[model samples]
Target: MKKIKNVRTVALDGLNAIENNQAYSNLLLNSLIEKNKLPQKDIPLLTEIIYGTLQRKLTLDYYLSFFLKGKKKIDDWVQNLLRLSLYQMVYLDRIPDRAVLFEAVEIAKARGHRGIASMVNGTLRNIQRNGLPEIEEIKDPIERISVKTSTPKWLVKRLSNQYGIEVAEQIFLEQLKPAKQTARVNVNKATVENVLELLQKDGLEVTKGEIVPESIQVIKGNIAHSHVFKQGLYTIQDESSMLVAKALDINEGEMVLDSCAAPGGKSTHIAEMLSNTGKVISLDLHEHKVKLIEGQASRLGLTNVETKVMDARKVGEHFQAETFDKILVDAPCTGFGVIRRKPEIKYSKTDKDVHSLATIQKEILQAVAPLLKRGGLLVYSTCTVDQEENSNVIYDFLQQTCDFIKDDTLASRMPEKVAAHVDNGELQILPQYFQSDGFYISALRKKV
Candidate 1:
């Protein structure tokens, strides 16, 4: 890879890769940052350009459409350059319009012919002079929300139908903001107060997490690379995600199963809650993912986590019925919840994806049901706010499985601020509600 000298070019290349290869924004951006060895100061600009462009892609394209009208086709890279430039000019107030225009033209000239550079220059100058097109002009409410928030029309409609239009709009707007960096304190290694003091001593801005009691929000600096994190005193996780282990209500000597566990955030949290006395059988479909679980366990010095590479739907084949005291089905879904962190998901996922994932979720729950002991809790979770993949899936499962009943005490286990939203043992957390990822968690108890 050629060394990119500036953040604009880096941002443009990242955007092109994401568009051409269907790459995830977060993974691709992180890889780009590491490969380029970007200066500490440039990293933030590169991240903002890439994520902001992706987050507001539809709106940026709408602005570009007015300028590109009747023009000959341009290369994807050229379009990406314009999108990133437009993103900085319109959304980022810190960067001046002249600097954005200068960088766009320079990058275009360096990578393309003078003709392409001129076109880029002219298009940007034209926008600066004429101003952006009006999002309000779009008459359809769904279309307006879609362009205004850079969300898909189908998703906007789906959310609006599920949660009223006003709430859906709030969710979309909330996703446009940056995600908070939070870490879960490994109480087995250090108390929350101790970890906060250590992190602050390291010059990181830290504060108590709003929702999960064991979590702390990093107001500044990367906590993942902090000494405390590497010491296994804490693990970086979203505050909403930290709630999973707490919902399980683990005891010291119980046997817990984490179905579809990967990158082991929740699995390790469960292990810590058990105080290393109980065993957490963490399973994922791929060997590489299982290794991730093992790696986290090793780093955290957690001895009670046992990892296995197995399809969650095939758990019954290897384990005896009623073999575990508790089970977690953190089944995969459309991932509509973490849009602020992975903005590409908004465009990449579709209505069909939601329904298909719902089917897979139900299957996973059915396969794991028999493995839980009588009266043992089975917690279901997904990082999505879509009803089809969350509540609807749980509703359908409860209808079919006669042995399991909703655990009404689930709300009491959650933070008091969030407890009121729990209904019939289910909690659907929207991004707007707590400024966290849109997550859904529900609990069921085997009553037979």
Candidate 2:
């Protein structure tokens, strides 16, 4: 108990990074783990507590606000300590409330004075006695969805307006916490069956991904830092994201382009699918990001990938029309679909931001359209659910562009589990619906 508390205190350093250093949760958390050299067994608990509190910040505050009595005041460290404690109390049944409260008091005492410790003790005891406050009482629909799902009100309003109230509420609710560690098995190194064997050998309960045939969801494993990941036996990717490579349908020796590829999860997947025989030109907006694709390619032992820095929105002037066998416009967007994986996104984004990103989506799609060969395939995708960034742009592009047609077999690569969403020349995946990030993809073919 004492050791775990010490580790929790260490994690607070990353929380400080999140607040003052402008660090991402994943990057910050990983850095803290490396620097502190925390034991592997504690990673699950530390990660759960950190991500859970961040994911449900608004909901936690809403419940805790009731415990604030007599013009109550609390310092930042006390608030953060209470947030972590309350998250454990409400979400983790294994940890007793007494233990949680004890840890909270200890953390409060270390970072603050006796006055703050007493308040922390009183507030946690009140929650233990009264239970979680009723979030159902929030009258405003936007605020209700926001608090219930722990998303920001602005995001709630935008999603409600975009995808009717019912679906929007469902999406937000699903985004609160979800299965985000889906990965694709590297068949070149080991078959899915063999990979499952290896994971099971390590006492990890793994399952085949529901949507993509080659994708696997590690239900009970932390092989990310283990030899499996380091040796490049598997790549972490959502099952829905794995669908993009299949949708592209690139054959070996074909020339392909991933115009907005950076982190190269999709680019390397394409190389693997083509049996490492095709040319995958990976272009991103920044030179520094090319190393990510290069690293992944090297780890996966994929030599087919070529990384460059070029904005897809301006690539028309550089690449000739119909020059490549396939082109991917993984356009940047509002990223609404990935909120479950990146809960902070809901708070960081605004309503106006969606439309601004939509303009970029349209521009990138339009510019990349001319670079596709007359008979080539173009697969447009985003980690967002907004229609303005999904169906709308493709609708407008087909009307204005020449020699493009919706390819019917594009959805055929998706497993039957996601067949229902396969519609109208495009298929969309919801976060919880597929137990993956919310992603949308539309496939188009340049006519001969």
Candidate 3:
């Protein structure tokens, strides 16, 4: 029998896998699209449905509770199907409610029994007729934002506490927008102007980055599949990520250490900054991920990057003290800043995780402190907007070490548009500010 391979079915399966923590949404969705050979047109719709379903899951459940009142225990898949359908009916204006309902019923029938199909049909129809409950009715402000934004209440509370309610709401809403694909021009391989023209010639709607000269935002088409990428003319990276390497300001013949470097975006960029003349020793705890740095270095034709499989916390032990001219600690965090790209992170992380990550980040910084040359630079960065993992970690680190002080040169390195955000030495970029991922970057210089 031919398999029922609808876009919604694929989304439902992906949603179940993400909710079960089996795989991340982006990787799983791409894998399914390629494995099933889903139509190119359906790719956008499928991605929207999966991300939308996950992003608005809390809000969907809130509305679902009213409809499912007095009902028996529901299977997880059925619930996921209903959530997927409700996400479309509620958020996606292009997809008609009737079409969404029909597709949901068909998918339920294929995946479950007739009884489940009837429940889906009846529930969705009832939602269409009666509409969802008002979010205003939710009493608690945190819970209200949580449901309305489909963000975890704990996160909502944390953001609100850190940056008042208005900014928190801004951050919450920003995550709902679909993430745009951006890439950095491998200036070593090709000039930015040349790369942009080539990307345009390849039919990509490209635009210059607002914050970085080396970045071009792809308005349409997949740059990864383009012939230009195969030639290593550009690399697919977020605009914020490109800034971390720039903050390091490595000169030719300098030696740099990228602690926690994997999938080597910043590490390779550091190599590119040196005109491929300096060495960038990239380290990651996992040997498998270390290959990613090697692969990226090879792709960009950068000979300066050397990959090593070792814990970032053991850098001092691996290398002699004051050996590196500069170091980058792109520490791992809760990933709160990148919710637009990975909606599942908001649900999986907690306050405890943030503090715990800060601990590890501090350890990495402490261990690598002795490895940097006197007067050398160290850049700390994360994909998250969380204060604890960013400035707090640095502040705590500074209190312990007298050899390092905040490097204010970071402001001069930034584009004029963002120069104002760099205060003293730390910067937190909200995703909405640049229409990019939320990021935090800070720079410190080792004293003589």
Candidate 4:
């Protein structure tokens, strides 16, 4: 029989894979857990160590630097062992510091040479005894928030420039935390009360979402694993994301287009809103993603959605001009807003990436603009906090397209709690304020 690997050892392997870009944290860890048949109880700690280590990487490295004092260059594995252990030391109050240090030394010895083991022991011990350096020593304001919040320096500066120092810091801090699990009820299959009763019957702690009536916030348990989930009673979607399709406000028998639709969250939601009546065209760039949309529609028993593997930038080439009653350009983005769920984004994305994604977002928006009929609603949305990809893209689009104007009707369609966040026909939901993923949504109408 194959022995189950130690949780720390498995976590270290997961961290190494993430460092080498072999896989993302979530996928790698889940793969490791399943492949090794890891114990159910140990899963949480393993998850905490890996995510906590990556989530607090920059901050941990900054603290480790004070101890090393630029004295030695250790092997990457040794450095990572110390990183994971120190993550527990600094962030996890439940794990004793001495236990963390001992685990690091042991893991180091098991994974590396004796010398490396000694180095890990010495460095972590020094930190436990002496504590981290004062963050105030970082002179630059942007650098200060970057290190303190463990976000990239470029993002800190950009957010500061866009929202000013105070709000930028808030955004940075919010990215370091984990996002809650929220799901949208498929009203076609089950009402909110019906789904809530079913979820509660399964012993899952859930509450109705404050902004969107169709959404529910799951406080505990793996909600997607519930029997009700398999019944197509609901879908796992962020509450903020559930608002995008609502902003479109499609009517029965009116055709709708979802440019850049993938995984079919919004497309299926739109189909649900239509009560499976009118047609909904879900377009994705890749064939595999198109299948995802198809699968979602099939599972929801929605016959109105038609999946197509086509680039959103060339959407006008396939359909006639002004052919659809509503258009949703949920453009690809830098995804700075979703760092809470994917902490690696804090390091993976750069300013150049943000600028590049903004261009693509603009191209997709301009390409799909002609497809909307006169007076048809066009809602542009992104799961990002970057201004270049959000408000700036919309501003630039408005400059180029005189036939389109901002539609403030987005507020009237949403609950009052959600409507309060709308401004000038655009809603930018910051993660900190909403306790959900950061997102931006803007509604526009084609001039008759």
Per-candidate TM vs. native? Answer: 0.98, 0.93, 0.98, 0.97
**Cα-based lDDT for every prediction:** 0.92, 0.82, 0.89, 0.87
lDDT of 1 by residue, 390-429 (tens): 9899999999999999999999898899899999989999
Model 2: how far residue 296 lies from native, Å: 1.0
Best by TM-score: 1
lDDT of 2 by residue, 303-394 (tens): 99998888888787788776789999888887888877666777777768878888888888888877778778899999998888888888
Give the alpha carbon lDDT tens digit for every residue of 58-100 in model 4. Answer: 8988898888876667777777887888888888899888787
Off by over 4 Å in 1: 1-4
TM-score result, candidate 4? 0.97
**Model 1 C-alpha lDDT versus the unseen true structure:** 0.92
Pick by lDDT: which candidate is best? Answer: 1
Q: Name model 2 segments beyond 4 Å from true.
A: 1-5, 69-74
Better-scoring candidate (TM-score), 1 or 3: 1
Candidate 2 root-mean-square deviation in Å: 2.5
Residues 305-363, candidate 3: write the lDDT tens digits. 99899988987677998899999999989998899999999988888999899999999
| Lowest lDDT 10-residue stretch of candidate 4 | 69-78
Task: Output the better candidate (3/4) by lDDT.
Answer: 3
Q: Quote the positional error of residue 105 for candidate 4 in Å.
A: 1.9
Per-candidate RMSD, Å: 1.2, 2.5, 1.2, 1.4
Go through the candidates in order and give the clash count of each. 0, 2, 0, 0
Worst lDDT window (10 residues) for model 3? 1-10
